[model samples]
Target: MMITNNPPVLNDTAILNIARDVLDIESTALSELKAQLDENFVHAVRTILSCKGRLVVSGMGKSGHIARKIAATFASTGTPSFFVHPGEASHGDLGMITEDDVMLALSNSGKSDELMAILPFLKRYGTRLIAMTGDSTSPMAKLADVHLLVKVNKEACPMNLAPTASTTAALALGDALAVALLKLHGFNEEDFARSHPGGALGKRLLTYVRDVMRTGDEIPSVVLGSSLTTALLEISRKRMGMTAVVDETQKVLGILTDGDVRRLFEKDVDVRTLVIDDAMHRAPHTISPDALAVSAVQLLDTHHINQVLVTDEQGVLLGALNVHDLFAAKVM
Candidate 1:
């Protein structure tokens, strides 16, 4: 039998077929992980949840990379966690682990020497261990208080000897565990935002109008009977594009903007003697200082307004915001 040296030329269909095959194999592996998520998985979750100290994840090589990602996901989602390289653990880093901490060990073969070498110390210290391995019968699995099996029938690599399929399976399992732990801990959006203060989602979830809006003395506010000139000066002084026209009780009665003054000029209205009420737009829409900036964005879009007055529940002026403010805060 002769093996053909010349393989068929690749085509779009062949490329798509290869991609589909890889996805199918990985999908099958993930389905297997889901099927195998039994009582042991729940036990692992319970152990981590009940741990008084942080979750310490330890692994070697490729498993170490996945372990670090898993640790980050856990920390950002509400569970306190950090990753520890097994090679370093024997070199004084083992001091980082405590009886209060739970160790999550990752090994494809369940027999990494660096990870195994510290097991005796971990056990002596009475620290709980959760093992993730491809082999359920391996020593690490047997020694662990809880073992999560990430078994894959074959690798997605064409040579059938790489970590592709196994790593994908492990990553999916780690995500599942993190989501489960999040639900178990009742982690909410606010909690997640607190952990991620530098991102867009963090700003959206954690930032209230009060945190970003120009407040109090920074606001351009004029009495309800003030002249349009005074209102314009207030708007210019505060640079908020508009001024809130308030009554004697400091309750917002209307809003005066450069646009309103421009309209008065176009209609030949007296600018010098015209009170703010004569030139003001009454019952202008307003937002609460506690409202989400995203809500202010929606209101701005819907009403075609450049600015909105920020008020308390009793219609008292508290602050003001404009599209520029949203832009400055990156909320836009």
Candidate 2:
């Protein structure tokens, strides 16, 4: 018998090389997809744009996972969409499909049994079909009113059978479709923020101090001539680490923080008789209530101040912000 020799072991470098090969293959597949964009892609987008009802996405296995993610991307980016497993659709989920809805199906081989089983039912419902497949002549593509060809050169898997490059190509195609529609609809960052209110981008873009900051009775404010004792009470009541020293017109003059109070204590200053101006930091950094929370974070970092007083362009005191407020808003 002839003995065959192969690499003896897998080391970290070998593993990393394998990873790089997979990434390179997938990257090439996606880049190839960009050149294939043509009138067919445009028709697909137009069909989806004209859709009055929800978009129903379906696939099997790895394609199913990508379909679910694509559905989520569509839903969050101004297009109303959801994913329905192809197998589930055959069982009972088909009831979710309606005449007004558009169906999007994904199949690497273009002939998944589960997906094929539902084609008749979808056609019967008069639902338009958009197919994403590797072969345009495949059954699913033939049945589709619009077929998006995602033919990839090869799989990134060493076995050349596993779904890797194909899936990446499909994912990139889905993103391209969603973003194209988003731009056509003129979706802006504010609209995106509305869709993802819990995320950091949303907080950085949409959050304003007036939406998260203490104001009116909750805001710690003391007159310039007020005694340090009164300022301390204001600070304690608000618990915002600082109090704004303002003139009688409610225009901010300075700020008195816990650090200033500690300094006063070290100096054995008389709180009852000393005015707020005697202990406050003059020319304190401030912002407008309309300023984004991210901007406030920048101010805090630049001046090394934990709190920032919000004022109008006329310099009238409006509200305040602290590092805690930025934390709570997720702007930090």
Candidate 3:
């Protein structure tokens, strides 16, 4: 007989209980942190708001990881900030700090050796300090112009030694700070899109019809008196699946699509004898070139049409775009 290679299975209820216990502990820590917020929290925000220079956040070990994310949040949401590891700042990185800058130091114990080593130098240099720590009486807290206490009742770790719940609370508080500052500074979606121009959201919010519409010779269009066959040829040549029918002033009169051609064929109509007037869709859907690309998508979806004409305020045809254009721009 050979020993079985099957792995031991955990009790489902026990495994779920452990996971839920961790979440409950962390959630409780956040609620307590909310209750603990007082004038100190206000002073921290005020100090950063009045600052003429950047916010330089520093921490050590696990707390340092949280501080880096906090710094990134601040930077992206209108507050100029970056992380400096306390260990590195104790060495030559200390020169990066300036009296005009505000230093935000994170240390759960408030007694990190590297951080403590730089506090006196920072004090002497006259850089305003904001400290986030568990101990209000610790040297880091005592030296800070404003102390935002992040004292959690306990860690989520079963051993109660890891920086689990405390780190979660710190991260949440940092997010609260960033969000408050951006709102106070009147940051909007356009501002956020500018900050994230390379992402899909940027494509949706920043792209305009003028930026992607086909103009000049690329526009598939036919004159008002052109034959249906001429319109079809123009559509095929431009590869847009539709052609705009325009008058003498280049004002759009109607649109003739491949779908219309197919329907006309199904009705046994004499296509060779027809003009654009007989085949074109009157007053076809149109959009403004200045409108956002996403608005064109909404028009297409609302009308159940794949192509839309771009027009100026006076109803003169400017250009055109289709669903494929928005897709290429990642606006769809």
**Cα lDDT of all candidates, in order?**
0.90, 0.91, 0.93
Question: Which pairs in model 2 have colliding backbones?
Answer: none
Q: Write the per-residue lDDT of candidate 3 for residues 1-332, one digit (tens) a residue.
A: 88689856789998999899999999999999999999998899989999999999999999999999999999988999999988888779999999999999999999999999998899899999999999999999999999999999999998999999999999999998899899988998778888889999888989999999999999999989898888878988999989999999999999999999999999999888999998898989899999999999999999899999999988789999998998998999
Give the per-residue lDDT of model 1 (tens digit) for 130-239.
Answer: 99999999999999999999999988999988788899988888888899999999999889988889999888887778878898699889997787788888988998
By lDDT, the better pick of 1 and 3 is 3
lDDT of 2 by residue, 109-131 (tens): 89999999998789888999999
Clashes of 2: 0
lDDT of 2: 0.91
Q: How far does residue 62 in candidate 2 sit from its true spot (Å)?
A: 1.7
Instruction: Please tell me which model should have the higher lDDT, number 1 or number 2.
Output: 2
Clash pairs, candidate 1, are none
**Clash counts for the predictions, in order:** 0, 0, 0
Query: What's the TM for model 1?
Result: 0.85
| Worst ten in a row by lDDT for model 2 | 1-10
Measured over all alpha carbons after superposition, the RMSD of each candidate to the real structure, in angstroms, is 4.0, 4.3, 3.9
How are the candidates ranked when ordered by lDDT, highest leading? Answer: 3, 2, 1
Task: Supply the TM-score for candidate 2.
Answer: 0.83
Off by over 4 Å in 3: 1-9
